[model samples]
Target: MDVCVCTPQEWDTIRSQRADALDASLESLGAQPVPPVFHTTAAPDPSPFGIQNDSDSERDPDDIPIFGEQLHAPSQSPTDTLRNITRSVRLNVNGVPRDRSTWKTLRDFVDERTIEDVLDTIESDRNALDDILARTSDYPESLSNTIAAIEGSVPAENTLPSMQDIFQAQGIASTDMASHLESLAAHFEQMSTALEHHEAGETFVHEDLHDWGTTWAEMNRDTEELPAILSEMEERLVSIDAAQWVPVLSQSRELSNVNRHSTKLVATKRTAQQNLDAHRRILDDLDELGEIMSEMLERQQAVEDEAREHVALLHHHIVTIEDLQHRFTSYQYAYSKLLLELARRRQYRDASDRIVNGMIAQLNAMTEGTFSSPQSQASTHEPEHGQYLPEDVCLFVQNAPTRWNVVPHNQELEVLPEIDSDLLDDARLRVGTGVAALGASQSL
Candidate 1:
């Protein structure tokens, strides 16, 4: 194989083609473009032979702009960037939704942050500002001295690495970078001075030592007056001392003696009271007994009168019954004759017998006695025989009908001989004795 040495024109054309190919590859892979370098050979041609290429100079990978590759250049001013950063940071801090007022607060905060950023940029690149002045030959000796003094004031460990260190490591230097740093520093210094003036103006509103003296004077007046008021109170208190209270002390002693004797007298009175109470109770009991006796006498008299009326009414009932039975007998005789007449007439034979039988049954019930009928075995009696019947018969009569002959039975009833006045007195005496015995038993 024969090697062909390439001309300068061909070399330049090959380098441009290689660069275009690399740019296309970077675009396809979403990667940054590689730095410029020399190529040793061209790509393969359409002919049978193809060539492998190597590089003459190794690409400096660090020289690529990372900021340009990854981040888009937003169409925003510095003010807008500062505002956005403030809004985002405020949302992160408070975790609350923001409105227009919140945005205004954020705007103020953004201004503060922008000024701080300017200050930080100025502070970090202070040496760069001096370097710019030095290159231009514009920095005075005193300014240089002041910078050196400030730098010396910072401890060695606390000092930040300069941009020159980065440039030296990369074998590159920025000619305009220092001038940019100087412009930023001057603006930052102006902002700082304005902020200091604003703070100083606000500070003047605070109270001075003379105002403190006024408060101290008021406190002293309160202290002095309070003691004099206390002294006057002390004099008033002195008027109530033991010497001035001798009469009151004597009165208190007399009252105490009187109270003591009154307590003893009350105890003696209680003893006498117990004896008097016993006598009064005896009199009360006698009075109650007398009242009971009087009530009993009145009840006895009423019972006696009621008994006399009841006896007379009973006698009248007996006579009335006797008269009714006599009438019943007469009716029976007439009915018997009528029955015989009907038997002779051959009229109502069974019906007349039934009615006669019912009448006989009713008569037996009323008289509470027995008399046999030949045909039906039904019996009846006269009123004279009714008294000889059982006591249940009397009870039956008492309940069965309301009137013997148009009279209330309960009204006609007499008090029994057992509840007579003489008997009532005897019972009352026995009841009083029992009650007294019960009281005594309970006391025991």
Candidate 2:
């Protein structure tokens, strides 16, 4: 026996002939139907050597469930992954039948599984975005409600925060009216330089200090009968006996209670002013948050304007937010003016308190006087012209006698029924001269 050997040229010719034969065989397999045997098992029964040379792989159709129906669990290892797929050589695409000519078995199988995984990722992202959007949808309604609450608390036209109303409400209580009226009158007489400067400055119209002239006129009218009352009181003062001093002590105690109430009113006003100053920026902060929400909503709109299912609802929230901003602007202006008015009022309130406090002291001094002789109680020394606080000076319209106001009288005239009328010698003096004092008078 002998071995056959070929030169380089002979080997090249043989290789070309084999290549052509393989290409022809590949075309023949691609044209024919894939036998069902290859589709039946992962490890099929062995066939003759000429069975397949280029086709990659095939599996039993029943081994793969529907692709999306049986999702791959993340815990499963790659080797255990199911090769479920939707596309098949038996199906048609675009009016043409699917077969070996248009579909590669192994490649198509892997591609379908990969596509399903990618779709799952997209679904997860969409669900996460939906959760965030649900929360986002609520913001505009809450913002609108907050703005409504603020607007409700605000006075109509910001009136209550103004000085006119603050002073008026605090000063006009039934128990406190007279004291405040008199105090305000005294304050006007001796206004502080700061008070004067505030009056001159233009923030809001001073409006004659909330129409002081009207108040002054009303005070004058109400006091018209006071002169007569004071006259009667003065007559009683001159005529009262020592026994009547108890009433004066009682009145002094009452005035002390009035003093306490007055101070409380002033303190309450101060607290209100402090509150206004503290929360001045609330509206500004709310407005900023609203702008931020609107910007966020605008970003969402850019992405979903055409495709969003709740486009109408989104547009409604945007409109509501815009309305809130417009309404908030009015409050901003009113709040600013209100604060200024209240600030000015505080100075006057202090001035008024000082004046009223001084008058209370003067009333205390007069009420404490008792019916005692000059020598029995040490005589009070006269105050010098400038010694008393300006408010302590009595500016009564009828200035009569200052002594009568400050000093207590020793007695009042009293009629004695038992005294004789004959001794007086008027017209006819009958048994009147003989009549003598009776009852419990002389014996005691």
Candidate 3:
């Protein structure tokens, strides 16, 4: 069965028609009645109730049959008779000429349209509530498992603290993980729902996946940004602490004399005096050696003077041999002339040639003998070969000595050899002086 409820416009139209009918009836009965103009004046305006003036606006309440339509007694419209209108009017029967008419008119205008709309709104709200309840009831087991896994994966340090621990640590009484999550949990709840919807391939009204991704991205960005700043700050604090360490350490450890050691200085006195006494003895020995060197030097000088005189005497004997060779050549030339004169008479030519040739041969033999002999070497001893051959030559040879003595450059003249006649006539005079001296020195 299709049941129809009357709206307020329908109720008001029905009430107006009923009131007109009653007035018509009372007027026909000849009782002093409400005037027709007054009835028009008394009718309620539908404008305030959001009701439109159209063909559907005016109709009789009983004309459409429904339950509860008889409360406006003589009018027969349920809206005209409802007590809520009477209560809103706050009126008594004494003020109106037709009490029933006013009562019916007020009752008819009891907002039936608003009531119908309210009922429709309530039915729709109920359906919406039922749909939400069904969706929540069928929440996927997979979604629950995913949530459990994600929660379980977090480490102990990252996980929220227990209720008692949070209270102790933060000094907040009765605070818990749920209390902390209250501010942000709705966003995660929404994200979880959207992720499920997206996985299911359903067209979601809100992009919960995008919201979840953005939230996770922001969380990761914060995680990345915070530690780098904190690390830098921690390093700066470490450097600051390091800067203060040297003074603190020096203050804790004081200076001490444990690092020092003893050293001694000694001076010796006897060594200098001993060295001086030794040096004096060395000087006395050197002076004695110098005197001996002076005596040896005088003997060396005498030997050198004698050697020079011997060389001069050898030079004088060479000059005398040159003079003897000149005189011998002259005597040979005179004897050859005498041989030529005897050969011209032819009386003893051969004998003359022999005698002349023999003389020249003898002269040549004497000249060669003198030239080859060590005549200069004989000056170092007695000149034994320079002694007499003829009486006059012997006299010259005997008087000329073989050795002489040289004078010093600072002194007078050379000392000539002395020959004593009596000494020349002595028995040693006939002996070669070098052999005789050698024999006599050997005998001694």
lDDT of 3 by residue, 1-444 (tens): 112234324533543543343334223222222211112222333211223333454664312211122222133343442333343334323223233343232123333454345335534543443443343343345346545654554433323224454234433311332343452465456556657877989874335436545555664465465556444433333323233332432454333211111100001123344545655655565575457557645654564454344334333322322222222222222223323332344435445556767776776666555533344434522355545344445344223222223333665222211222232333233233334433432332
Query: Which candidate should be chosen as best, given TM-score against the real structure?
Result: 2
Among the numbered candidates, top lDDT falls to 2
Q: Which clashing pairs does model 2 show?
A: 239-412
lDDT of 2: 0.38
- lDDT accuracy of residue 219 in candidate 3: 47
The TM-score, computed over Cα atoms with residue i paired to residue i, of candidate 2 is 0.22
Model 2 alpha-carbon miss at residue 3, Å: 74
In order, candidate lDDTs are 0.37, 0.38, 0.37
Over all chains combined, what TM-score does candidate 1 have? 0.17
Per-candidate TM-scores read: 0.17, 0.22, 0.15
Top-down TM-score ranking: 2, 1, 3
